[model samples]
Target: MTRRYVIVGNGPAGVAAAEAIRRHDTAGEIRIVGGEDTGFYSRPGLAYLLTGAIPEESLFSRPASDHDLAGIHRTVGTVREIDPQRHRIVLFDGQAMSYDRLLLAVGARAVRPAVPGIDLDGVVTLDNLDDARRILRLARRAKRACVVGGGITAIELAEGLAANGVETHYLMRGDRYWGSVLDPYESALVEGRLAEEGIRIHRGVELAGVIGRKGRVAAVETRDGSTLACDILAVAIGTQPRLELAHLAGLQTGRGIWADATFQTTDRDIFAAGDAAEVLDPETGKRGIDSLWSAALDHGRAAGEQMCGVGRPYRRPAPFNVTRIGGVTTTLIGAVGTGARDVDLVTLGRGDSNAWREHADAFAVVSDGEANHLRLVLGPDRLVGAVVMGDQALSRPLQHLIRERVDIRWARDRLSRGPIEVRKALQALIERTVPLGAA
Candidate 1:
C-alpha cells in the first residue's frame, strides 16, 4: 500500500523532509504545502542580500522545479487548521488535504515592538525575501534610518542600510551590544567596528513610539524623551513560531509546538520540526526551538526518516555555526550562555536549547586580544560551551569537546596557565576522539 505523507511549510525543513521520505520509501506519496511562491530560497542568504553581497537572483539554492524531479508535489496555500482525528488539514481557501502522516515544519515570523505608527508604510522587519526587497526600495528614499534590537540581524540591518548611502542610526537599550551572549570585550569589538562604518550607535535608549506624517514614518520618539529623524525603522528584535494550526490540531505546545526526539508531536501520526518545533535536545535532555537553516534541514531529514518508520532515535547535533559578525568571521559551538532578555537576540547566541543561559552561571577562561578572542565555559568536569571570535584555530577542537562531553577537567585547574595549554589540550583530546582525517 502507498502511504501518503503531507508536509506543511515550504521552508528548508519541509523540503528536506520530502526528499528524505523519497529516499526511504519510493512508493510513498509526498506532498509539500507552503504559502510562499518563491519555493525554497536561503533564509540566511537574506542577510547577504540586504548587504548586496549577493545578487537577488543568487539567493536561490536550487530551482523550484528541482523538487518535481524528486517526485515531490508542491501545493501553495496557507493551512487554516489541522484535524488530527480526521487526518486532514484545511487550507485557508477551504480546501482540504488528507494524509497517513503529517509533518508541521511551519517555521516562524519576525517580531516587532508593539507601538503606535507600527502600521505605517515605512516600518518593516527583515523576515523574508519580500521584506528584503521592500527595504531595498525604502532605502533609496530614506534620508536617515534607525535599527532597533540587538544580535546579528540588528547589526546586519544597520550595515545594509548604511551601505545604501543612507545615514544609519543603531539603537540599543543596553550599555553594550548583545549583553547576554557576548562579553563586555566582545561587545566592544563589534560596537567599535560598526562605528567605523559610519553607523551611529545609541546605547541605553528605547523606542517609545513612532511619529508618522501622511500615514508614513517621518520621525521616532525615544523613551529618553528625544525625537530622531527616521524615514525607515527596521526591527530585528526576535521571532515567534506560528502555532495556530498546531493549536487547532490540539497539539501540546509551549515555546513552540512540542515534539519528541523522533519529531513526533502529542498526536503520534503528526510531527513538527524547524523553527516551529520545540524539540528535545539529545545532549542536554531539554526541549527548545531554533531559527537556523542548518538545524531545520537536519530536523526535516530526521522527522522524515521517523515518519518512514526508522526505528532509531535522532541525536540532535551540537549547535555549530560559522557566521559573520561585523565583517569578522566567527564560529559558535554548544551551550555558550545567553544574555539578558532585553537583547532580544534569539538567533545564534544560545545553543540547541534556549536554556543556554542557565549554564552561563558557570566559570569560564578566556584567551583575549585586540582581534582574536576565545572563551571556554567549564562545567565541573567537562567542556560545557565556548565562544570563538576573530581567529578560528580553537573552534573545531572546542566543538568536538563540548559536543561529545569530553572531560577537560584537567584543563580547568590550568585556567591560570593561559591559552597555549588550552589549545594544546584541545588538540590532544580531538586526536583521541576524532579520526586521523577528521577534525
Candidate 2:
C-alpha cells in the first residue's frame, strides 16, 4: 500500500515539501492543503507587484499545471483541527483527511498593532496576492500614505508607495531603523538614503491610532499628539507564526512549533517547517526560527527527505537576506541580529565600550564607511556574521567567509581598522584558505 502524506499550508515550505516528496517518494500519495484558493505565489514578490514592477500572473512561483503534472492533489480550505491519535485532520469546511505522515508548514501572519481605528477600511497589510492587488489599486489614487514598521516589509511598502507618486511617511517608534539587526551608524546610513528618496521618516514616535472618515483612513495620529494626513495606511510591523493549529493539537511550541533538527515534532510522525517551525541548535541548545525564504525552502526539503525514511539532521547554512532600501542595496548574513546574548560586537571608529572583551571573546562591529559600510561579527576562530550596505561587491566574499567560517585571526590588526583594511585582510585570508581558482 502507498503511504499517504498530508501537508498543510501552500507557501514556500509547503510547496517545496510537496516537490521534495514527489522526488523522493514516487509511490507515496501526496496532498497539499492551503487556505488560499490560488496556486503557489511568491509572498516576497508582492512588494514588486505593488510597485507595478511585476504583473499579477508573474506573482505565482509555480503554475497550477506544475501541481497537476506532479500528481499532487491540491485542496483549498483551512485545517480546523488535527486528531493526532487517529492520524486525521478535519477541515474548517467539515471534510476529514487521514495521513500516515503530516507536516505543518503554516507559515506566518502579519501582525496588526493594537491601536484604535486599525480596522479602518484604508488600513491594510500586504501578506497575500490579494493584499498586493488591493494595495496596488489603492496606490494609484492615493495622495498620501503612511507605513508603520522597522523591518524589510515596511521599507518595501514605503518604497512602493513612493514609487507610485504617493507622499509616503514612515513612522518608527525606535530612534533607529531595524535596530534589531543594525547598529546606530548603519541605521543612520539607511535612514539617510530613505530621506534622499523623498520619504518622510518620523522616528521615536509611537502610532497612537488611525483617524477614519466615513470608514476610510483620513490621517494617522501619533502618540506625540500630532496628526498627519494620509488616505492609505500600510502596516508591516512584523509577523507571528500561525501556531494555533499546532497548539490546539498539543504540539510542543516555543516562539514557534518546536521541532528537532530532523524536523520531527514531539510526535515522530508529525513534522513542522517554515516560519512556524523552530529548529534547535544541537551545540547551543538554542531554537532558531529563520523567517527567510531560503530557510523555508531548506526546511521543507529536509523535512520531506526525513519523512521518507531518510533521517538526517537539517544543517542550516549561515542565514542570509538582501534588500534594497532607498536604492541602496543591503545584505545581511549569518547571526546578525542584535538579540544574541553570546555574541560580542566591536566597532572601528567608536570608542571601545563593548562588553565582550571583559566577559566573552568573540564580537562584531561597524568597521568602516566610505561610499559603503562594512560590519563584521568575528568569532574566536572564524567570521561569524556581516552586514553590508553599498558596494555590495563584498557581499559574496563576506558570505563565504561567514558561512564557511573561514579563519581570519592572521589579519586581526588589519581587520580592526574598517572596510578598506578589512577587505585587504579578508583577501589575505582568502588566498591562504581557498584555492586560487576558487578565490
Candidate 3:
C-alpha cells in the first residue's frame, strides 16, 4: 500500500515539505490543502506586488500544471479541524481526508489593532494576495497613508507606499524601527533614511484609534492625543501563529505550534513547520519563533525528510533577516544585541546614513552608510547570527562565516587597515570541511 502524506497550508514551508517528501519516497500519495486561492507564492514578495513590480502570475512557486505533473493532489479550501488519533482532517467544505502522516503549515495571521474605527473603510492588513490587491487599489486613491507597526512589514509597506507618491507616516510604539531585530543605533540609522525620503515616522507612540469621515478612515489619533490626517491606514502590527487547529486537536502550542528539535509535534506521527511552529533556539536554549522565509522552508524540509524515514536531526543554525527599503538592501543574520553583557562598537559611516556596528561578547556590528550589518558570533569561532542592510554582497560571506564558524581574527585585524582578502579567508575556512585531496 502506498503511504499517504497530507499537508495543510500551501506556503513556502508546506511546499518545501512536499518536495522533501517526494525526494525520499517517490511513490507516496501526497495531498496539499491550502486556504489561499493561489498555491505557493513568495510571502515576502507580496509587498513588491503591491507596487506593481511583479505580475500576479509570477507569484506562485510552481506553475499550476506542475501539481498534476508531480502526482500530488491539491485542494483549495480551509482545514477546520484535525484528528491526530484518527489521522484525519476536516475541511471547511465538510470533507474529511485520512492520512498516514500529517503536516501542519497553516502559517500566521495579521494582528489587528484593538481600537474603535478599526472597522472603518480604508483600513487594511497585508497578509495575502487578496489583501495586497485591496491595498494596491486603495493606495491608488490614497493621497496620505499611515502605516501602524514597528516590524519589517510596516517599514516595507511604508516605503512602498511612499515610493508610489503616497504621503506616508510610520507609527511605532518603540523609539526606533525594528527594535526587536536591530539595536538603537542601527534602528536610528534606518529611521533617518526613511525620513530623508519624506516619510513621517512617529516613535514611542501608539495608535489611539482611527477617526472616520463619511464611513472611511480620515485620520489616526495617537496615544499622545495627536491626530494625523490620512486618506488610508495600513496595519502591519505583527502576526499571530495559526494554531487553532492544532490547539483543537489537543497538541501543545506555545508562541506557535510546539515542536521538538526534529520538527515533530506533541503527537509523534504529526509535525508542524513555518510561521505556525516554534522551536528551541540553539543559542538561547529557549523556545523562539522565526517567521522568516528561509527558516520556514528549512523547517518544512526537515520535517518532510524525517517523516520519510530520514534520520536527520533538526539543527537550527541561526535566525537571519534581509530586506530592501527605498533601494537600500539590508541583511541580518544570527543574533543581535539581545542578552549580551558588553558590546564592541564600530561605525563605518556617519549621521543617519552610515553603517553602524555593536559587538559585545560574541556579537559584531558591521555597517556601511545607511546599511547596517550585524553578525553574532557564538561559542569560540562559530558564527551564530548576522543582519546586513544595504549590501547583499556582504551577506553571502557573513552567512558562511556564521554557519561554518570561520575564525576571522586574521581577517578582522586586516579589515580595518584595508580591504581584507575575503577569498583567502574563505579558502582557509573551506579547508576545515573539505579534505586536502579534494581541495
Candidate 4:
C-alpha cells in the first residue's frame, strides 16, 4: 500500500510542502488541510491588495488547476487535534484521517492586546484574507485611522490607510521604526519619508485602551495620556505561533515549535515549519522567528523532501526582509545586531541619505542622500547578510552575494576607491545568474 502524506495548514509552507512531496513520491496520497476558506495565496501581497495595486484573483500563488493536476487533495477546514501515536489528525468536525507522515504548517495568528474594548466594532487585525477584506471595507469609510505596532505590517497598514485618504497615525513603542531590523539612522530615514507623506508617528507610545461609541471605536488612548481620535484602530502589533495543536500533541516547542536541521519535530514521523517552527539562524546562532514568505516556503520544501526519503539536510539561510513604505523601499538581510560587538557602523551621505551601518563581519553601505543603502555581511569571503534601500538595482547582486558568498572584495574596494569599475563587475555577476531573456 502506498503511504499517505497529510499536511495541515494551507499557507505557503503547507502548499509548498505538498508540491515537494509530490516531486519525490510520485504515487503517494497527498492531502492538505487548512483553516482558511480560500485556497493558497501570497501573504505578502495582502498589503498590495488593499492599495488596489493587484486584484484579489492575482493573489493566488498557485492556480487551482495546478493542485488538481498534481493529484493533491486540498481540504478547507480546521484541524482540532493531532494524534501522533496513531499518525492521524482529528478535525473540528470530529473526522479522523490517518497519515503515514504528517506535516504541521499551522501558521501564526495576529496577537490582539488584552486591553478592554478589543471586541468593539471598527477595531481589526489583518492576519489572513478575511481580515484583509474586512480592513479594506473599513478603510473605505474611515476618516481617521490608527495603526499600532512598529513592524513591517504596521508600516504597510499605516501607508495603505494614508493612501486611501485616511488620516493615519502610527503608534510605536520603540523610538524608531523597524528597530529590530534597521539601525537608528536607517529608521530615521524611513520615518522621515513617512512623515513627508502626512502620516503622524508617535514613538515610545503604548496603546492603553480603546474608547468606543455605539460599539464602534471612537478613539485610541495611549499610555502617555494622549488620545488620538480615529474611526478605525488597526492592531499590527505582532503574531503568536499557533502551537496549541503541537503542544497538545506533546511536541517539543519553545519560542516556536522546536525542530532539528532536518525540520523534524521531536516525533520522528512528524515535522513542523513556517511561522510555527523556530529554527536557528546560521549567522547569529540564535533561535529566530522566520515570518517571511520565502523562509516559510523553503522550510516546507525541506520538510517535504526529508519526508520522502531524500537524504538532504536542511540549510537554514540568513533571514531576509524587504518593505516599501510611502514610496521608500528597504531590504534587510540577517540580524542588525543590537550593540557594537556583533556589528560595525558605517554611514554614507548626510541628511536624507544618512544611514547607519551595523556589522562585525558585515558591512552596510547607506546612501541616504540618493535614497540608497546596501549592507553586506561577509563570512569567510561569502556574503552572509545585506540590506538595500532606494536603488533596488543592487538587490539581485546582493542576494547573489548572500547565496553564493562571492568574493567581491576587489570590486567593492574599487567602488570605494574611485568608483572605477564597479558596474562592470556587477554586470558580469548579473549575467552569470539572471537569464539573458529576463535581463
Per-residue lDDT tens digits for candidate 4, residues 125-221, read 7778898898888988999999886566777777778878899988877677765456677778888988998899887788899999999999999
Prediction-by-prediction clash tally: 1, 5, 25, 7
lDDT of 2 by residue, 282-349 (tens): 76676777777777888998899888878578776777877776667888787565652211111100
For model 1, what is the error of residue 54's alpha carbon versus the real structure, in angstroms, after optimal superposition? 0.6
For candidate 3, the per-residue lDDT at 317 reads 68
lDDT of 3 by residue, 212-284 (tens): 9999999999889999999889887667888898888899998789988778889988889888888755555
lDDT of each: 0.81, 0.79, 0.72, 0.74
Ranking by lDDT: 1, 2, 4, 3
Error of 4 at 225 (Å): 1.5
For candidate 1, what's the RMSD? 2.2
Candidate 2 backbone collisions, by pair: 344-363, 345-364, 346-364, 346-365, 367-418
Compared with the true structure, what per-residue lDDT tens digits does model 1 show for residues 1-439? 9999999988889989998999999999999998988778887788788888999889888786778888899988999878888899889999898999999999888777888888898998877889999999999989999998776778878899998988999988888887776678778888888899999999888888899999899998998789998999988877788898888999999879999999999999999999899997676778877766778889999999999998467677666666777777777676676545545454432122454455554676777777988887777887777889988877876777777787766556665357667666566667766655547
Query: Which scores greater on lDDT, model 1 or model 3?
Result: 1
* Best-fitting candidate, scored by lDDT: 1
Question: Which candidate would rank higher by lDDT, 1 or 4?
Answer: 1
